[model samples]
Target chain A: MTTIKVNGEVNIQPNLAEFEFKEVLSSDPSRKAVFLLLNNKTTGKAAILVADKNPFVEDGSVINEWIKDAKLRNLAQNDIYGSYELLMPEKFNAVKSSLIYPATDKHILKYRRREVYMIYETADDYKSITKPSIKESLFNLDWVYNFLDHKAETDRIVFDDPDPNIGFMLAPDLKWNGVDVDNLYLQAIVVRRDIMSVRELTGEHIPLLENVRKQVRRVVKEKYGLNPNQIKMYFHYQPSYPHLHIHVINIKYEAPGAGMTCIFLDEAIDNLKIWPDFYQRATLPFVGKEGDVLLNKFREAKRLNEE
Target chain B: MTTIKVNGEVNIQPNLAEFEFKEVLSSDPSRKAVFLLLNNKTTGKAAILVADKNPFVEDGSVINEWIKDAKLRNLAQNDIYGSYELLMPEKFNAVKSSLIYPATDKHILKYRRREVYMIYETADDYKSITKPSIKESLFNLDWVYNFLDHKAETDRIVFDDPDPNIGFMLAPDLKWNGVDVDNLYLQAIVVRRDIMSVRELTGEHIPLLENVRKQVRRVVKEKYGLNPNQIKMYFHYQPSYPHLHIHVINIKYEAPGAGMTCIFLDEAIDNLKIWPDFYQRATLPFVGKEGDVLLNKFREAKRLNEE
Candidate 1:
């Protein structure tokens, strides 16, 4: 296993191991850290954290932390349920940027592209995308899994039943048999271009530029109604992929990726104890739709980086 | 402050409360124990746990627990997250002659005649139903509370977020914060119903239906291309609206509703946690585009029920 430890936990690392595990996001595990793969020969000693997780990339505290903590630990039996296993690289730093809403023309272009991708070629495309195979099963959630197996690459499919209520999603091939059966949410793969545009900016920029991490989060939430707490973002500086994108994964309520909430799940539910407010606050960024305000800031920063 | 002690737990008697809460069609929380209203000088004090945490029921045990537990505390502290406290009633004992399916010509006719009582109508039917204000805000969930405040209810609305990835049934006036939000990923909902119905029939059901829960989860992974774990289900139940239903909400990896996966805004997500496998095993009698196999089962069940 090639070990690569990235910066603050925004960059996601998939659990390709035989079991499930959690890595810290920040100094205080509740904050954000990097997810690392600990191995001697493979990817070498490296770090992976989402660029979005860092607000200010230049700060020595943050930078030095990345430089100093450059070791990857083999996921111990106990680590499976602790943190999301995220780490950042030393070369990268976070910078805040101004808010710049996508131009109408640009919005139209993106929409059209998405529309084309959705519509595709035939009636079957529409049918397959819209129609759900709601065949009742005896034991397994087979239809969902089957659908995932088939449509793992192309489109996003949603299934609905009557009562006009509960729904589900089918992502690509994600495995969990015994060691990591509990945390069964999808793992999102994000690319670097999704967040950064390294242009040059001379004038005073937004102070929030340092906090590019939060901006990426706001965009993801606004565009997709993903809750931050349930999901963990991973960043990378070219250990595997070239661009620096954040991989966001959904950690089911039952998943140990919950950190403090895990404490609540372990303690509060049965004890009837109140969930610590900090857990609630910490996970607040994950609720609702992604906020554009944050996304715009990142986009502006990217634009300035290019200029 | 009407406290009804059940199993020695001081719960605000859901039955006696302003918003009725029930436990309908559940496998666990066996529906045998009688519940007293503590201070109900009005209706019969004796109540029973009705349902398990099934996805089909709007407010299953999951909803009731959260309201009686978390939200209630939040309300008391005056944290004021949003309006509309969710509740799960004790029984889904209200036997209905027919369960309407959203498909088939007959279903539509029945919906027009028996179920849908148009309390309000719009001059421009299509226009009113697909109003820009509602359309724009449907997926744009960040403005949820804001939209609720200004949404006009002069016409009945059926949510269809242009992007089929999301579906909702929002009745602003029908909510506590003066707005009720019920969003579902359409395809996934159908898959969940089928899975739930199948479980209802099969005796071998997990008390906590996590394994089977993946039926609908596939769509988030493959179809919409989301992090599967990122999708969260929120559930709520109200006796005034007899029956059960759950709202399927997806939290992006970094949005606000992330960390607290178990924390349901309403009863929509929780109820699914405990739904009996019998419900998942059972099927819908009517067949239509929406019903899938559940409809076929429903038809069989209807015949059996009639016989």
Candidate 2:
């Protein structure tokens, strides 16, 4: 394998992908970077989706047809939960995709999930209910990962369901949902066994989250001792997650991205059921704080014009 | 005023702001650039909300009380609309704001509006009941100014309220709402007399938009021969414009940024009515495509952390 690096100042069009990937590597690194060698996918293309990330263009549009490859990597059981939703040049072959707001079901291949196949198993034989949310077969977060991670752990946990399939851990830490989670009485973040975001959502993954709403409802009503109407279970569009989790908060509480950036799990599920094409047929909205990669993809695609 | 130019490969942190402004100037020119002079607003700060025009940061979170001056410009009536929402350093003092996804009213200074004190009157006085949709006002789409400047000659105008207080221009452009407008239906782009975005929506602007829904309902019913439900009015989060405009489209149409990037006019109106602090109280979520400035502001503010 050859590693190609483009350094120094260069005009955008010819060196666009290399220039962008260098920046992408600096800010985001969940996926490996793809190099443009002589026989590379984007060798002659003026505009190409260099990696499976968002659309990174040299200018207004493209000049050539490009190919992409999976920057493959190996994962341990601990990382089995991460959303490997990286797009490859090959993905477009499976579907008719658009850089402009994913226009059709054919564009569904845009939501690429990293290859995840392992089922993690902890050293100890997993118990049924030491805690409902803790799945013994999942990645264990440590203090080393983040010095402030302990702050989240110290806060009260409303509920924990220990099933590996529907495994989850609950925390009423103010960090998950919004800033006023404690003050406004908004709610907690319900972390799952996996560490991923909504981009990984698909028909196959839909069934995995099947009981999330039901389980959350039952526990909130009986275990947490709260009224069902006031409790709300939702997901932030571009949620900040070390691990993929859900937010269960009170409806009366108003917080960051609450209405705009979030969607009710019930609403998401209903949307899925009504439109069988759900993930593919419907338009999945994402909020990038402004200069984010995903949002840039839309801009480069010309779907969203930046003024 | 001193103009600072940055060129070639250099370590950031040192010449960060100048470096950033160079790139900003390269892509978006609607907003002026601010250099971090020794006594600059970002002199000692790591990250700063330099100036809001969608691009937010120079690098990291901020420090120091920054000062801003308006980069004045000359405007011709022909060059009516354009990106006039860049927040100068001076705007923050007038408003209370937050960076938690545009949460507090503090960040409210970001939505800067150009001083549009004049009303454009077409040569014909904007006759009523001409056409439902016009191609002119949709995206005038000039690299610089808004072409809706020529109101009368090109298309049909249903209503052009001369009062700048209730300043709104209505045109039924099938393009304003969705792609297949002829068969599926009705539309309008309610151009506000002033240059601003939804984030600039204060109580004062509400009165201007008051009769819009009522007027559209009546006209689409009487003139266009369409049901009021078929006539839709909405707002794009990041609309293409020189001034703020409302998208009045049909409900039957399936289009881009439907759920994620749009808010219904009625919903915005109700939200303002129910909560007088409307813009101040709620969190404003933005979709950031790679290299966007405002989204960068959030990242610099630490509201959006890259993991």
Largest TM-score belongs to which candidate?
Answer: 2
- The runs of at least 3 residues in candidate 1 whose Cα sits more than 4 Å from the true structure, single-residue gaps closed, are A1-307, B1-230, B235-252, B257-261, B264-307
Worst 10 residues of 2 chain A by lDDT: A116-125
| lDDT string, candidate 1, A49-159, tens digits | 111122222233542344243222222112111111222342332211111111133332322211000001112311232112111112243343444344443454322
Docking class of 2: incorrect
Residue-wise C-alpha lDDT for candidate 2, range A1-307, written one tens digit per residue: 1222324322122211121111111111111112111112243221112221222222211201211122212111121111111222332111111121112233223322221111111111112211122333243455313322334444554555555455555555454442432222423333343434443455555554666766666665565455443455667644554355677764433333332345556545544544334433223343333434434444454444221
| Share of the reference A-B contacts seen in candidate 2 | 0.00
Docking class of 1: incorrect
The local distance difference test score of model 2 is: 0.36
- Interface RMSD, one decimal, each candidate: 29.3, 24.9
